[model samples]
Target: MPTTATPYLLRSNTGKNSLKGALDSLIASHINQLGPSMLVQVEAVTASAASLTGKVTVRPMVQQQDALSRPLPHDIIHNVPYLRIQGGSSALIIDPKPGDIGFIIISGRDHTHAVTTRKPAPPASFRQFSMQDCVYVGGFLNNGPDQFIQATDHGWRIVTPGSVTIEASHIEANCDITTSGDVRAGGISLKQHVHGGVQTGAGASAPPQ
Candidate 1:
């Protein structure tokens, strides 16, 4: 019978070589290619006060690696256009600040070359209704007053957890007004009048005194 090679011999030679080859292939496949489109983190931003367009400097978070598995320094992309989403009644413009992460795609050529960046993630705590185009949150929005509109076990509610005040030049309601609490108004005028705290029907005779 032919002599079989020992397990140690197989591991020392063929097994180690095959493992190395597989690892190299996997790393190569996963490596990021140097190109126009890349995932990047914004290093700094310069917004234009005059227009929605602005410039942003970014560093590539995804980068290619050298043969020895060392990461190579990527070129810092600068003056990339902070683009706005067009074709809507209102444009959605993005102004990226420092530490914001996004993806960028370089387009055009020569003098007209431009880089477009967009933030891929939303704020950590936010609830969006895409169909209604509305958003609700637990925190303050856009330096405005805190107002909570949320759904409860019973139904939906628009609530101000503290004392509430409404100020307007004029307030009008097209439908009938109903309230559970006492309502005090400044000289309320109604098409139908109320006498002695009771609303009387039109053309109805008063009860005997």
Candidate 2:
């Protein structure tokens, strides 16, 4: 197991003490140094719905090899940035809970300046591809969600065993509903309770006052 005192690459240098052997070992060790991504188990997450800013505490699921090739646990990383999926007027809010497993992508160089400025900036630190610099992206759970919203090219679908609630100042939808798309609960139509402005269409019921 690689520890703070042991250099991971030098652990397996039992081949020879020659300079050539040393160079070969050094070259081989470089492969493990460039971290593009790593599987991590979420220890905890702190999220702010208002600002949509937060950090994650995670532990690397994969261990580094020591000279003896024994598995060692990585120290739990704290205050790593969380990647929030968002755009101009919309954002997907998915906060990870403890015990959830996910992945963290590593940047080629330090990105503290970029993250702080929310723009492209020079690396603030000399660190390259270090585990200390990672962005958490959740949803790599071993289990699945009971409720899900799926969208396809043809249609959008929301499925859940529990009640689905939509809170808005106004609700409006346009659809071909001669045989479908009516408001219903327990197979009973709630169209009668709905207020007006429904356009007349084939098999469309008149909007009642």
Candidate 3:
């Protein structure tokens, strides 16, 4: 009768008097208690239409010390999740790759599991702009140099030190137009034109001699 607060001795599955044996024994004895969440190492990954299946080895916690004399037990658990694949949300598709470490949580008595993949370390080319209340994706240009779109409380905003060019088949606007630069409609007829703070209609003509 081992209480939750009681420290139990771990024994290996092979009955060997080694650290590995002790950790294995500890995991075996507390497998049920280790749920409904456990850290797992992804050995293989298979993608289906809706979900991702991972052949993961569960790392069970044991009351023992590591090789460096650290009081942490690292044990490998085989055949975890019972070959079940967990699907992600429709908005986000999760594709877990091999060697991806993650966690699996048992969600139901019938052994339905929920898996979440951990993010890997970013590469040297990856860049990000982070602030106290704002975050922007930097080092990525769109249409011009030094351009970045930032997410704000109001909405998304594109910032650039240079000019911006937008190409679209059609454009629609529901608000008034304001700009410091000149607005030109290429190869299109104009109904009126404003020059030198004076509006000229299409019916206006040049003076005759």
Candidate 4:
């Protein structure tokens, strides 16, 4: 078994490391036990519901290892810590750490915000922030209906309804299901009931350990 190391803190917008490296670190630092374990989830970029988008799918560079290595089921997942895509012909590369946890990519349409999930949740943390936002620091097991991450008119927000069960949930952060994107639970079971949303199978949803 590999020892779980403390993750390196990420600066907001330094742009030093590629998004891929941040993701790899997230996986390596999480699970230390043997056998199977869920590492991280990634949200990929796609078209919107109202947009009339029609295009041919381009095969990713599977042969190329110099840029980004193909994500594997054994590799731990980590969202790109800091790297923004702007305009045309903009490119960046990231390398992930090696592990058994799977990886997922998340991209936003209008604007993207990476919520820090690696930090420890403060005592009595509760409130709603905005919609379509991402949380990546840690998971909170909230049992209270009023104390959960919620969606508002402006954006998706967090409402800590009550004391949430942090460990029972997957991912470093818990999202408030603000938008219509695919959240690959990897077939994760919830100790609590989800309010509502459509679950899709983009990756392998293995049985939880």
- The lDDT for every candidate, in the order shown, is 0.53, 0.78, 0.44, 0.34
Lowest-scoring 10 consecutive residues by lDDT in candidate 3? Answer: 130-139
For residues 101-175, could you state the per-residue lDDT of candidate 1 as single tens digits?
666654222222112223443333332221111111111113333566678999777767587666689888798
Ranking by TM-score: 2, 1, 3, 4
For model 1, state the Cα shift of residue 127 in Å.
44
Pick by TM-score: 3 or 4, better one:
3
Q: Pick the candidate with the highest lDDT.
A: 2
Residue 135 shift from truth in candidate 3, angstroms: 24
Residue-level error in angstroms, candidate 3, position 72: 22
Q: Write the per-residue lDDT of candidate 3 for residues 59-118, one digit (tens) a residue.
A: 433335656877865455444432332345433334444454555544333221222233
Q: Tens digit of lDDT per residue, candidate 2, span 75-178?
A: 99888888767887677776777888889988889888887787989899899988877888876755877778988898887789988667689877696555
Which sections of candidate 3 miss by over 4 Å? 1-146, 187-203, 206-209
TM-score of candidate 3 against the unseen true structure: 0.28
Q: What residue pairs are clashing in model 1?
A: none
Candidate 4: list runs displaced more than 4 Å.
Answer: 1-72, 77-79, 82-103, 106-146, 149-209
The 10-residue segment of model 2 with minimum total lDDT is: 200-209
- Across 4-115, the per-residue lDDT of candidate 4 in tens digits comes to 7654445344353856566656666554221221224233323333232211111122222333666533322223332233345543222212221232222222123223
Write down the TM-score for model 4.
Answer: 0.13
Task: Name the weakest run of 10 consecutive residues (lDDT summed) in model 1.
Answer: 131-140
